[model samples]
Target: MPRPLMHRRHVLQGGIGIAAWLMQPGARAQVAAEPAGASAADFWRLARAGGCVFLMRHGATEAGLGDPPGFRLDDCRTQRNLSEAGRAASRQLGLRFRDEGVRLSAVYSSAWCRCLDTARLAFDPHYPAHQIWPALNSFFQGQGDAAAQTREVLQRAATLHPPDNWMLVTHQVNITALTGAFPAMGEVFLTRADPQRPDRLSLLARLPA
Candidate 1:
């Protein structure tokens, strides 16, 4: 059977310029040098030391442009969905995390389908009922109430007893708002949330895309 044609409306809608941003020579170099030490143990050790939050962008999607002017949040089926590559990538990321024995106490994601899908495929089995944190939504064209939302999420994550590690799957703008750096697809930014110095977070690592 022939595959159904993909429509522009069905294109996963979030940010459109990520590929161009990532393709920049400097950006490519940054990503290339972003990963931590070769061994998974090294990555775990880094995650443990700082008790940082893992902020990730959604996996690849079929969307070619930003959301339409009248996009409705409740009707995801009418919006863009994950591409085959994206679905595979999400599963692979989950497998990698499992193999690495990364302990995640909480899983949070943006309300967008791509982010939600990534969180579902990547961590739902381990951390059921992944929470939706709207602040983690994409900041396309840098327009949104992302900063306030990010602060609220960070505040909540900090108060968790025993200080368990958290994984937040969000969009570039939300991640950038918190870290002052734009993350590529599948990239993760680890940072500590300290109220005394709200802006004193450190960049532990930028996971591979």
Candidate 2:
């Protein structure tokens, strides 16, 4: 049996809490391929050529949903953070990128501790991950300024071209909203922004975590 084809419209219709569904156990193992007729192999080949942005959800975090009340961005203890397994997975992910010989032009991360940690632990020492503030923050649980932040991220991505891949370590909601796909923890998607349509993104491939 073949998987159902995914249309751009289908992704746009993914309603609220889509991010929550993606966080379920075994979620990371679920592979979302290119729309039925698209060639998966070709997507990877293009991705390696570096003409797109890589949207990455942070690695697994300690047990929790959203954040505890009064969470502070500067305080890791007040927020749900990465577990040891998550750290190991992040490191392995970085090695995988290295193994692929993917040269990144820039790596940006949300200010949230988990995102910052993921980018640093995984891509640092090779690519210095920089903070892009709210550009990649989670807005699912009523975080404000999501629209503005997303616009900023997309705007930055549009200016980039080949031989330079931009990797953004962000939240699931943000990724879903942009590309209409809910990326699991540690999942990375090679995506290209539609210059004419700033709100739309074309998912090229699901890079192994």
Candidate 3:
């Protein structure tokens, strides 16, 4: 079974609704009741419990929308890439998980340079398998492609490695399409996929950068 599909406009509108709720005072308290350090500790503890997936948008990118003219996936120089600070952030993220004893069973990444760089820097030594998951690719250039890509990503999430911590390093559009929320750069959305419904997932929490 799959959850009902939403149009792109509807998805973006729903995301806006969620963003509004997160800005309210009451919602802020619900997200974290303790100090920053304590809250982070609690976040990882839940993550360590497994049966969840970390949908991570790539780290900060160089100034640009999508990619520059004539961008080539094989060439990082041609693509909008990770800034120096982005690289550092990625490394720190990996260290956080390692220090907190979160075992990442698998790491899947988009083939884009920024995405690959983030995963490599953050989860290196534990190499991530990069692939061209259409669901994670940009559809800004073509509206007709969005629905297919969204479906593919949802399906993958529904059946990827289960009962363990897994990760997907992708772009904002991809994450937004599946989760109905626009995650910030380097932000991680902890999600649990519904076993009975491939298109449905519950957003557990947002791990800020």
Candidate 4:
């Protein structure tokens, strides 16, 4: 069963309030300094070396904790969507990728608006949003179907044999499910595909928050 829906206005306002709290001068510094046990340079190097695949979490969203009751895959407007900060973050993230010379051969996103919006805003000029998978949505409330869906999506990604590198803008749950690692907002994870063991994924780098 799906979770109960909440008022969009309330959700948005609440998220904005939380963001304000976190963005305080001292809090922002702390957030920026939070360690993910990996260095940004190391991640960038791995991306260059192995033709990395980046699994990114969507930017901030105004929506409440999870989806409303009876969430449907085909309809996105009803879902929790991105906020202004999220949109701006997406743009900044894109610029960061561009400045870093990260070339994405293809881009995929969760069907949810926040994920799609992030992908579009971040990498659309280079790699338009081409793929959407239901499995990539959030599992925050433990509603995502990760176990059965990840294998299928990974298989599809494999067949693509994407050029130099590929990017996937998705929710936290999907990223965690695939990499066995949790990614914070705006974080990127680099992984390499091994020919000897196609299913075996090697973690290249976990970009800092």
lDDT of 1 at 181: 64
Sorted by lDDT (best first), the order is 2, 3, 1, 4
- What is the Cα-based lDDT of residue 19 in candidate 3? 61
Q: Which segments of candidate 2 are over 4 A away from where they belong?
A: 1-16, 19-34, 37-43
Q: How does candidate 3 score on lDDT? A: 0.69
lDDT, candidate 1, equals 0.66
lDDT of 4: 0.65
Q: Give me the runs in candidate 4 sitting further than 4 Å from their true place.
A: 1-37, 72-75, 138-144, 156-163, 194-200
TM-score of each prediction: 0.73, 0.80, 0.74, 0.70
Identify the leading candidate in terms of TM-score: 2
Better of 1 and 2 by lDDT: 2
Off by over 4 Å in 3: 1-39, 126-134, 160-162, 195-197
List model 4 lDDT by residue over 86-192, tens digit each.
78878888888778777777787887777888898888865555577666765554455645666665665565443478888886556655654555566677876
Worst 10 residues of 3 by lDDT: 29-38
User: Model 1: per-residue lDDT, tens digit, 7-97?
Assistant: 4443333234545445433444433233344344555676665366888888876756656666666877655566788788888888777
Q: In model 3, which residue pairs have backbone atoms overlapping below 3 Å?
A: none
Model 2, position 116, has a per-residue lDDT of: 90
Question: How are the candidates ranked when ordered by TM-score, highest leading?
Answer: 2, 3, 1, 4
Best candidate (score: lDDT):
2
TM-score of 4: 0.70
